[model samples]
Target: MSQDRDAGARLGDSSLLRKLNLAAALGAFLKAPSLTLRELRAVIGVSRPTAEDLLAELLTEGRVEETTPPRQPSSGRGAGRPARYFRFRAESGYVSGLDIGAHKTLAVVTDLRGNTLATSRRELDPELDAAGRLSAAVETARACWVEAQLAPSDITGVACGVTGTLRAAEGVHDVGHGPVGSGLAPYSLPGFTEVDVPGALSEGLGRPVAVANDVKLAALAEHWKGAAQNHRDIVYMFAGHRAGAGVLIDGQVHQGRHGAAGEIGALPMLGWEAAVERLHARGAELARSAGTAAGREGEMVITSAARQDPESLAVLIEFAEVLARGAAVLALAVDPEMVVLGGGMSRGGPILAEPFRRELAKFTLVPLEVVTSTMGADSVALGAARLALDTVFAELLAVPGS
Candidate 1:
């Protein structure tokens, strides 16, 4: 017995086991609501006593609370009382997600349970200086937090999605230097790529911010609550002001070595340049006619005109081919089961989907199911919130030591 005790201590501390078990139970409870002790133990693969002990730890921390167990409509007592259930105290913490795009900045605040408390959006001037745009993005975040009736300390963390590559260690998203093309390119949203995004947002919000590619974050939203729910392998295509894709393998975003795996749509030879030309021309026409902002671009004018204008519908069909070409390239490489069309352009619907399918069929051997994003443009912001929520909970309640 002494030898066994010595061996166990040598291997690891017994307290570590309890901490791990508690983390598992807390994670399971967060994912699923109102779990009875038996169900909780079974779900997390722990003994009933271990589950109860972990639950005691959670209750003592004010992280969980006993709740009424579910009952039938025509309820009758089986014994002295029904099984008790418990849930995480969702109000104990909050998180914010932010989407900083080429043309817009959006922020959403959510409780630990994934409920959206408040949200805000603002159009960004494409020609603004880097500092001004960064300021605007952080302001949008603060505004959303205030709208939610929360304070900076109340936010457990923040996650931001931006257009370019995110360098986590340096806390920035570096948009490419120089012009995207020679002159007058639609992709000419300058001063964004090299900004210290995480540093700026953190300074304003008073909490560290995690950064991810906007399209990748949109894909995360697709998997969590939108078109790609229940899917483990998916390609989420973002086709708004600029085009991008997010690849998910086994329910995780595959960001690639340089965080540039799904940038297929950026290839000039792959029809992205042509698609941008056509889409921007239409948007420019509408902007001139309406006397709106000169720099307006992306899905708004196209989708609006598509509703009634034959010319716009034709343009959309042609551009849908461009979209399909990009999807085909990604699908060929990864062979994803589903392709989710997210971003503002996803609203183009069957007019876009039908023709896109026709063109996409031209490239691949694998069968693919395509769906539009139900979350629309909000996906990125909401996805960022989800990321923040996960990190916050993991940091707050989960055990260390892997």
Candidate 2:
């Protein structure tokens, strides 16, 4: 039995072992920032020779860089040799994230550590065609990088969040294109149905681009840095121009088979479509009552009305209840511990949250800790940045499918 166990241990793949060792060293450097070879050897619990070999490997890949330490003072006997230190090069490359919506496009640039160095938002011309809109998104992305004094060449990867199902060949189109349901606008932008979004963005940005459903990216943002951090399972509901949920299960965003898992609002039977419709209708009413622009009905309008007028408050409550209906169904299916309310409507604060709780309570058997997204309007773009970093780290670390 002892011989057999020894044989099993000896049979371990040497290349895989080295990979694990390098990854461990890289992780340690990221946490420690600056670590000496002796400190890393102790932390990694490896022989000095093995640690030296791992450090060389990382240095070769530029994943880690060595630094000269300040001269050490002489001890009672003699001067101790100053050991060289290494640090994780978190800014070795940059990434960009874009959130493409009907009304506007938002872009963010970040370093490898996910620090938002700059951002830009541009409203779309409703009259523009698909090509024009794509140009606008590229322009905004360029503007963000310019604000950060970076060129597109600095970007290692780019990920985008858009308001519909993404088929690389078919571009982005609302689920309404199929009987998947509606409340979403049709693909009115000429040539949009065949735009090749990722390809277009890649060409415009001079790097490969990945596209994801916007609501799903919102969920990813919440999981990455917002209220859902560390929780494996969460439901991120976006209640702005449209209401939808981004689901995370077992610590990963659940894209499902075709990436349309949390699109319940598409079902008119769910009442989510009417919910948003009524909110806008009430906003127009309140705007007129306040002697404001009748057509100026949006997230702010709902929040203002809910806060200032009794009748508007009632409308907001109903609106929140309608969203709760969809959320209730999602919760029953996913049983997530956290639900993050986000998007433009979430700016309404308690106006949306309070009534959402009241209605969600009726259907849920257990208490769900609901919170608002701190990323605000930047949620989707930031989430896309997270995705871009994953891609960057995967290639940088030489780990496949990161």
Candidate 3:
């Protein structure tokens, strides 16, 4: 018996070692997907027991689950049991997404699976400083937690999408379009200097925070779950609370060399002063015709008029036409598969789609499909949470040999 055991030990074909390596690979597989055991073994290299042990650890921690059990042939001569496959628990933790707009800030709480559990919104005074507005946004997020019956500890991280420009080192700056800046509009709030909105938000929630442009966040959300899903390349154009855009290429956000990939709003649609004047004029016209209440009812009137009134429709078509011109330039540069229209303006789908498509077709020969976002106002918040989840998974996968 001792001789036989010795022979068995000597006959080690390294199958055990392979399995151990596979176990280590399982952790990385969980983070994303579509990894075969063979691929894992090549990368991690371990015995079967070690692999099994790693899988067991993940199972015990509830961090992984069998998404697709291994397939085995019923009549195979050497087959015993099927290999079990596992994946990360995408619903395990929750992340918070905050979208700060010109008039309000919205916060949404979602799990790793992108399921929203609660949401909150607070109207802004426009007169409030950056710190005050951020504080209000934090409070609103806490309220959302309460509404969802969740404690602050339940959150993993917070992601914020803001208007205006941001610098990596100095953080979000009230530059170009703030009260003190020469571009966009005037916003006279103090702390208008480079303020780290994300850092402040991270401190407030006691977790790390991610920051993005509001338009970019909307684009991310749409790319993930709305109109742009399955499109590897998409351009998201937002025409509300000021016009801006976000570009997605190969399923990743493209922020450009200076993190200004989609700063289309600053693309000199007109001279800065002319653009601001046009904005004010447009706002005033809408106010007089729609009672200037700036509520849903007023917006409806503006939309309704834009539809029935040829003159009004022409004006709107012109907006879409210029936007299409912008999109044409984007297509010439990026050549995305789809262009998604979002924000309050997108609520008028057909009102804008046909004209934009027609105009865009005139400029670019690329067969680009244009569509309206169905995620509506929730897109940014949803995208923020998704971004946070992605960040967490990326960190997990970065573990050595994971």
Off by over 4 Å in 1: 1-12, 43-50, 73-75, 169-189, 295-311
Count clashing pairs, candidate 1: 2
Cα-lDDT of candidate 2: 0.79
Distance from true location, Cα of 20 in model 1, Å = 1.7
Please provide, for model 1 over 369-394, each residue's C-alpha lDDT reduced to its tens digit, 9 standing for 90 to 100.
98888997689999999899878876
At residue 185, give the lDDT of candidate 2: 40
Q: Write the per-residue lDDT of candidate 3 for residues 276-339, one digit (tens) a residue.
A: 3344455557667766554343244346556586545655666677777777877888989989
lDDT of 2 by residue, 88-118 (tens): 7877789999987777889999988888899
TM-score of 1: 0.88
**Local distance difference test values of all predictions, in order:** 0.79, 0.79, 0.70
Ranking by TM-score: 1, 2, 3
Candidate 3 lands at a TM-score of: 0.79
TM-score, cand. 2 vs. native = 0.84
